[model samples]
Target: MNGGTSTTTATPNPSTTAPSAPKTSKPGRTSPPNSNSPPATATAPSSASTPTPPTASARSGGRTEHAVSPRLPHGASYTLLALGAALAAAALSFTALAAQFDNNVYDWLFRVHPAGHRPHEAVLLAFDDRTLMDHGGVRGLRRTLASTLEILAAAPPRVTAVDLTLADPGDPAEDARLAAAMLRLPGLALAAEMLPDSSGWQDPRPEFLAAAEAIGHVHALPGPLDEINRMIALERAAGRDRRFALALEAHRLALGGGAIVSTPSDLESGGVRIPSRQDAGRPLRVHYRPSSTVETLPIGALLADPARARALRGRVVFIGVTALSAIPDRLFTPLSPLDGNRPMAGVEIHAQSFETITNRSFIVDAPPIIPVALAFALAAALAAAFTFTSAPVAYSLGLVLLVAAHTLPWLAFLGRLVLPPFAPVAASWSALAACAAFRFFYVRRQLASSEQTTARYQQAFHFVAHEMRTPLTAIQGSSEIISRYNLPEDKRKQMGQMINAESKRLAQMITTFLDVERLSAGQMDLRSSSFPVSGLLDACLRRAQPLADRKHISLEATAADDLAATADRELLEYALYNLLTNAIKYSPEHTTVRVSATRDAHHHLLAVTDQGMGMTPEEVKNLGRKFYRTERAERAGIQGTGIGLSIVRQIVDLHGGRLSVESAPDQGSTFTIALPA
Candidate 1:
């Protein structure tokens, strides 16, 4: 059980695990509790729990807790990081930023698309400066209105909503003519204004109001910051009096005049159901068409040519004084002229609002969560591309993301969904910037690490090459002496032996260096075969005997003669060569180095122990780090390139084994390699 536990604990889950996606809950749109409705709050469904992967923190905690799940490839980690940043930015857009940026983007989209379709039934009759001058100023304005109404009454329009607020009494005689004309027309609905203070509503002269078929409020609320009129309130209240908007009343009367009927949430008249704005109780968003789309005629012309009024027979005629001097009667609109000075006439604004209601072309918006979710998803995609792809390809993908962000809004606009462009564009750009930053840092880190490794390897290569010269020089000198001189048999035999030993050492050094290179480059595949553990240990001892003899150290091995391992024989031999050689090189003269193999039920342990100047725990901890050598080893003039143990560890890992070190200052050291039996 203990052995099983140890094995289970030793091996870890793969390092490639990452979170599949960001775990976030979207807030559903909720309505405030109405006096007659139950109190309630709506929340989006919660996300599922994410799998935790073992990270540095997890390992240090000795458990999987606090582990960050790895859902992305190692190179694509930047993509996930960017997604997190995009979500944060999007959330901020709703709070501290207050969606100002988002609104601005929407405003831009609104202005860029000006050519729009307007309802065919709504028409504008402007009492402009030209019409006023052609008629005879304010004294004649009432006559002009009365005359136009008479002409409209002759043919009878579907509905005639005079946007004129005839609040204060007009000339009594002229008012009588207007009232008479209004009474004669059953399709006529007059406009009125309600005071913000809930004071009594204002309407045309009492006689004129009494004579009109119906009365509707003409007051509109401007947008909060810009004071732009984009939406028209469907209804307004003045104390006990509830009045519908001019557009709503006109629409109702146009469907055939009758007692206006409506429900708490909608206006219903003559079996026509017009849905009211209920989301957050916001006013209906006006889908404004160009000012030119509302067929317009000067009020004077209609009065001058009574026959021309026949063309206005089936339309809902909106009559208002748009003369610049006629009270500067204009408001800023989304489709306002590009010059920024030309505001749409109040009459035209009313026409557009009424047309919007009649045609049911009100603008809709996607849920707030949509743009946010899409932004994060795009950011993730960009991050992944930036991480795994080349610079040109990643940049191209980023461009694609940008185009996608901007284009989606236009498509949504076509569908009458007012999807703000800024959040997505801002999110995508922010994500790209974040991913770019990550790529920059990632490249920098890799370059710095690579440069450091190169420097260490270059230095180690020079040292090892220098060491090779000594053995090569010995072989060359011994061989040259044997061939060049007529020496005694004993001296010749000794020289020949020296040359042979030096040749063997040189060949082993070359082979080990080549193996290290191949392993570092990931080109070495294990060539597995079964071999006796004793044979391997004995071979390592024999290889190190000459070096151990030079230091007057005894080499010893104790292992089961029958025990064997299933791994590449040549690779194991190289690993043991490094271990045994290091044991001999680091130990003091006359010290003994012990090699032993022991097995449990699941694994075999091969330990190399040396009674030498041991290391501090810190030193032992750093033993297998490439090119890491202790200060004591440096001071003691030990000849080492510092990568031998690194190579040994790599080989053991390739053979599905683990390397462990045990050491303490002044207590010697033990290096253990554990492999499955």
Candidate 2:
């Protein structure tokens, strides 16, 4: 109704998808036959042009000629339309930009991020050469104790979260300096060291806990199975109390909570129940910044460096050390550079988690039902539109549909559209494209069939014409020789024999040609009647006797006494005759050519095996093509029309049988016809 996107709603028939009404068109359509006078119909095929269409009907219902099993009921169009609309709607809804994005499947969408954009307030604690040279090396804090409290007071930030651990409680002044910093910053939180409670002892640092406004157990986020970080959990226990996770707490602190958050009964349903979180979540989707190489900044640079430090004022600063000390617990984020090294501390990861929660952006997957409906609708629409058009246009439309399906995922990349990339769109487009290709090629084949029929007729005509010339010329020459000159009795008899031989060759050639023509036209109607199987071999053996005698080749028949099959008599006879003739023709002089028919409990087989100058597989392959002779045979000067076995195959097929040949150069071929007994 609205530019091909309908808005009508109907209750889905839960029982079935097949719609009901008067038939309109089939699932896939084909055109009616061609337009020629006399009009081709299944009945009276020969007299009524075989390749032509019937006169158009007066129904005047805008019908197109198509070859399909059956038509879809006209009433079902609304159902098809409804399904299509639903698909389009679902794609738009879950795919939109402002929708709740799932951080879980983000790396699936984006694999590599360039230099990320960091706009959040975060501080860096650089272990400078000055601090290192003051003491010794890695553990330089043992000497001169500097107060972090002074640093926190100087930089005005909403939150002061430290990443370091006071592993050694012996340095009382150093511990005191950190504690003093916690009291000065009202929103300051310390990353607490986790002690395994296996011994049932709680080692709580009262002074540090008392000074800090909030204490978060320092724990890192898990990376993807492939070491990629796409998501962070926002809801978790801070410590003993069921308090908000550090990220959640940070977000709540920034947005100013309306009510203490409570667990809903549906926390398992992947929904976060936080009060007045709209603002905090709106700005947390930060572009990432790599912490190594060019992205590295010393602690002094964050505090003393003007450009970045100016940007950090009034924003909450979460300070943490970026080190790869996995002998201890680490902040295992997805985007670390040290060969998939997990983030070492949880404090900085909490900053990332807070940033994501505040931004309120996530990825969403469209419903499964949407794409399924989409594919069916797309396939149906393409089939409908091209049902009446020429092949080229239908093919072009198919390609367009294919391209459209391929381009679908790009919407998610550029404009945040989560369309189906796997089953429905891809699968349906492929099906449509296949339909288009098959239909187009099938029509072209039918046209070619008509032309081939004409060509076959032309070739048969010339074959007959050429055969007549040989015998007619011989007869004329023989008569002239008799009339124009005196000849001895023996010489006259020889000339008569010459004329007789050519005439006989002409007859066999003509009969064979006619036999094939009838078979090709599909007019050689068979009269199915049960017959004695050995009767067939017995008949062909007698027919092949003369040809065998000419080369002194033995034509032998061996068969089990009784085998039965219900099939046409003449068709079977023709097939066996061709096999016998080839055996005699290809075998060398005096070679035995065996003709046998046997029946096992399951099936009956008719086999012809020849011994002599056997053929290569290439020769056997060309044996069925009209006018095609094997190169070796032509060189050997064997002569006959080339379509004998082609006719044989047609006859075998009519009997629901298979014909197989086995041969190699110099090894005789065994041709076997297998059929149900």
| lDDT of candidate 2 over 93-161, digit per residue (tens) | 345331223332343344343224545444544434443443443454422223334554665567665
The TM-score between candidate 2 and the true structure equals 0.47
As a whole number from 0 to 100, the lDDT of residue 642 in candidate 2 is 66
Lowest summed lDDT window (length 10), candidate 2: 43-52
Q: Which candidate number maximizes TM-score?
A: 1
Q: Per-residue lDDT of 74-124 in model 1, one digit per residue for the tens? A: 555775677777877687757634455655656667788753664488878
Residue 165 Cα positional deviation in candidate 1, in Å, after optimal superposition: 2.1
In candidate 2, residue 269 scores what lDDT? 14
Candidate 2 overall Cα lDDT vs. reference? Answer: 0.54
Q: What is the Cα root-mean-square deviation between model 1 and the actual structure?
A: 21.9
lDDT of each: 0.72, 0.54
Q: lDDT of model 2 at residue 508?
A: 58
